[model samples]
Target chain A: MPERSRAHEWTPITLLPLNGGPDPARLADSFLTPTSRFFVRNHGTIPIVDPDAFRLEISGMVRQPLRLSLDELTQRFPTVRRPALIQCAGFRRSELARVRAIPGELPWDEEPVSTAEWGGIRLADLLAAAMPDDAARHVAFEGCDDVEREGRRFGFGGSVTMEEAARHDVILAFEMNGEPLTAEHGWPLRAVVPNVIGARSVKWLTRIELRPTASENYFQRRAYKLVDRAGATTDAWEAAPAISTLPINTLICRPRGGERLCPGPIRLAGYAWSGEPGGVAAVEFSVRGGAGWRPARLSEINLPGCWREWTAEVDLASGRHDLLVRALLPDGSAQPADPAPLWNARGYMNNSWARAVLEVRAD
Target chain B: MPERSRAHEWTPITLLPLNGGPDPARLADSFLTPTSRFFVRNHGTIPIVDPDAFRLEISGMVRQPLRLSLDELTQRFPTVRRPALIQCAGFRRSELARVRAIPGELPWDEEPVSTAEWGGIRLADLLAAAMPDDAARHVAFEGCDDVEREGRRFGFGGSVTMEEAARHDVILAFEMNGEPLTAEHGWPLRAVVPNVIGARSVKWLTRIELRPTASENYFQRRAYKLVDRAGATTDAWEAAPAISTLPINTLICRPRGGERLCPGPIRLAGYAWSGEPGGVAAVEFSVRGGAGWRPARLSEINLPGCWREWTAEVDLASGRHDLLVRALLPDGSAQPADPAPLWNARGYMNNSWARAVLEVRAD
Candidate 1:
């Protein structure tokens, strides 16, 4: 809520129940992430609303159930803009809670991802003027934030999958990085959905229904699926997978996890994506952890669901190492070399092979 | 130029015959500044033009000189935006070139200031359609690139005082913080001028003229001015003065100087300003070097030539220290507790009293 520290000073951030994120070595300094060093996941606890009395309702399986108002949803739709990359299906839940304890949530390292440019209109143009029907097949959303947990009161919900709300890069954002939308982001609306998983991009938004399934809420059926343990029940959290797009990753934002290297060359860099008919293709790097890798260079921005900005230079020596990083997917899948058999239980997508360490020494 | 490093890792920037800047501990991490960590400064090179054949011109003492283009200066005037804070009268010229040896130049350090938003068009609505001439006092501007130095071939120029170019917060910029202008900034025009001296904000802009007495080019009559030594003569730089606005400074941007601290309650933050009707008004802080200081808080924006955001907490205990900081101004003037008595001869405004150092240890 403001107590959130670590915007970068050799990374390592943790702060608040607000879910602090970032420290993929300060996300390798830039490819856009500066909304105060972006990364603050939040679930409930942050609702003040009132941007001239907000509004937005839209009712379920609609044929006509609107509500509107934030100046009639920004002067009747039509705005659009993109830039994507959202991240945060617990992006690296602290490397799966250091491989053991996933306890009461909040671990997420690698700054819950960023990349902005949003702007709004087009949740399929407000579900095509609220005529949705044909028995809607999922689109929920919610969020005026409530959060109570084992004591009842809820709010932050989610859904999607009506072909991911008729993608065209989803949207509903009310601008970000072109301003207008700051009340801890979601000043007038918020649901961007690009590349998915940033908890379905909801935030202060007030409902949106049109469903026929997939919104048994509790964070669209038990906190972003992919279960295996941590108190599951409810039929193994509705048979696993509910984490929309975002998968083939890559990160290592510079030699920054406790960095202290010396022995020559280095440089490295970070970012890399995927999510949607396979996106990022090739990002490799190793330094020993994977035994042999190399090949970085990327940056001609691959787009489709964003992220890409790599680099290389290698050549070290002196001692302590680790390093890693991975990614390749354009359907070629890659990125696995061990996340301890993809854990889960609530730590969500820990991606795997991203490592860091360093130490070198011996000028 | 992509080879420049340390944009962060606890500040200390310096790179480029292209001038980089930023390490007033990363300019206290935000209150605008970030066009890739702002603070560039370049006086030569980086000018490729073609924002669809930009133009500008306007000509001296006008009656109707004109030229315009860039879509007739955005459909003839009216844009405006503002935010300001430009800095760099060689911001702390590397602590007055480590107190002596000024030599050729570039030692910069303390990141030549930033702050943005800009946007454009109101050079008093293009000097009210190029009418000017009632013995127009001083305007000048220039730019289109060039820059050779110890062998001649110049270009970047400057001037002002047509009552600081008809105030209303100067302008002429063509957007920044909202895109449009990046060939390392200065794409289709530049000249924001607010609170002056950023080499008079004259980027790739080409000509504006008017003048009557100040700007005989060569960096407006023998480079930036101020006087007191380091290779003076041109009649002591035409008898001193020409360094426009900016003065009551203050920096520090969080612990960062040789940081290493451990002792206890540190915090401290940074940024402070004052240019025009002497703005800032209070910022203090110290830790031995200045004897006893304290008071910091600030940040309700204040605005005058901008900057603000301040903080403080202190406490310490173990070894090495230093710290400092300063400011106060709204006419109370304060800030020179020693930058070695404000050096000069091209190390322009150092302002002094900022310090840093740190190093505690002992957990």
Candidate 2:
């Protein structure tokens, strides 16, 4: 049984089953999310692992299988630090869930994502020592968390393409925001995969496998995959490709729904990024419902696979307004104008145009 | 002797002498500033008062002088609640302080202000019973706090015009955010003069004096006044009229100065208000050094003598740029484009155009 812990201070307006993100008002305070304020996304009970007894085993299609303890792993490899923004595949799932009765995953609304400074040994460095052949096309990671589904027990697992694992930015992070990971966010070891959907960054990591194909674990095989909007059968599950990168996306942090706004200048702030090669190129806002768009000022630093912060100031008059945000990606693709066309089971990859209806009163 | 109390939770970024305001980011979270996050502007030590023994005495230019206990005060008059934003005249004084050596006052920045829900007996209600004479032109409020300066002991004091005090919004507040005031925030009662500088909202209830002219108390006569920037002499201090209504102004809450921003959409959020009769009419933003300006979306509720929230989304590319915000009052006056014209010796009333230099990097 998973042990219950004291409540976290960073929990925002939460949804059910342990999914919450920091309020955007607080998120905009700094460039990096402090450990106390970082978002927590957990699918199953949090496992309490003793770091002294923890070991990460590397096997599957490698020249030499090795088991390395936490201390040994740290002392043996050169550590590298990188900053990345990890967004959940189900981010903005709340928008989709609103369109229909999409069941299964936790309904998220721009809170399942956060940016952090990660430090760890490069996964590629260890893989090179183990010497995988050309047949090794993917890398799979498994965690100690036991998630029960339909009375069957299985561990949380995920995989990424070999090319992704080889990137210098992809690290096996042990330190989050310059400190050891907290138990709530995979204390001992976890993979920090940048620019990809958060599900692939498996937490509480216990094993790494060099494989000829993607892992067949429940999450890798059936879950976190993009499927047809109408398909809910086994055949559809078997044929769909696993969801990997995030689509061009934007999230409105201010002027949240149901808020009473005064008539004057209001600030619209949010985060935007993409999984495409060049990342998010531009983010724009439209006060009118898709009729006009104004470019939001982007941040100066645009790292591949990272979300950049943007800001703009617009004058608002007394009335209700539909504030819209859209992102232009490096691949020239943009968020769809409407989410109804992309609705799918499990509410995954619901990156449609982001809008907030604001009430501007002139009291 | 002054009382030392436990630290307060609502203090903003500070310079010295213990004056602070709400963080704009936190202030933007909701319409009302939480009690724990409200701004504190203290020139001297906070007084520890026994609420049971607290009495507010009303005298001077009235038909019948009256002294009422906390209990009697509550029972005799109807309690009213009002939501108002209180801002220090020195808000954004740092912008002016940066221009030159403006000494004596705490070096304030983009804080020194906050909005709160205050509940108390209206001064008007109590005064109606006292029946003020025709000679009363101003109402002076004196506090129990003993502030020592130049080896003389005197309490903090200020006054408003008789008509101003007669307004319904002016209250002897005993509760903040639905709870009794904290020790740090003038526990038993404090005068809440709406749409005025915070100094006028004297903390720590003691005595109210009706007078034929504005109070000659040191603060009312020598401090909290507008003076020419070049006037640093006693002559300048002697000639200037005490500062009264706040001018139209705006503040930038997010993208705080000296922050690292990435390339993408950024959100500019802030608070705006005018002490003039009609309140804030509009707030505009400029990135091209005031060559062109864009309007920000204002919140719907625009209360008189209170600040309204505003937001705008502007697209920005990678580079260093200056962002500016200005407010337009209902009376057709706008914020000065440059702050240099408003610089003063005490750094009071520094409501020039608010500008923040942001570094937009493409890392």
By lDDT, the best candidate is 2
How far does residue A176 in candidate 1 sit from its true spot (Å)? Answer: 4.6
Local error of candidate 2 at B52, Å?
81
DockQ of each: 0.03, 0.01
For TM-score, the strongest prediction is: 2
- lDDT scores in order: 0.74, 0.78
Candidate 1 C-alpha error for residue B262, in Å: 46
Model 1 C-alpha lDDT per residue in residues A1-363, reported as the tens digit of each score: 121222232332443335565566665544546555567677667677766767889898888899888788878865655557788888878777777788877766777787765667778878888888897898888888777765788778788888888866788887665446666565678898877787888887888997778887788776787886777787777776587878878877777778787899988888888775757778888788887887787653344566877788888889988888887876666878777678877888777778888888886
Worst 10 residues of 2 chain A by lDDT: A1-10
- Model 2, A40-90: lDDT tens digits are 887776777877888999999889888999888888875655567888888
Error of 2 at B277 (Å): 56
Interface RMSD of 2: 22.1
Please, what's the RMSD in Å of model 1?
A: 22.5
Task: List the candidate 2 regions with Cα displacement exceeding 4 Å.
Answer: A1-17, A229-231, B1-363
C-alpha-based local distance difference test score of model 1: 0.74
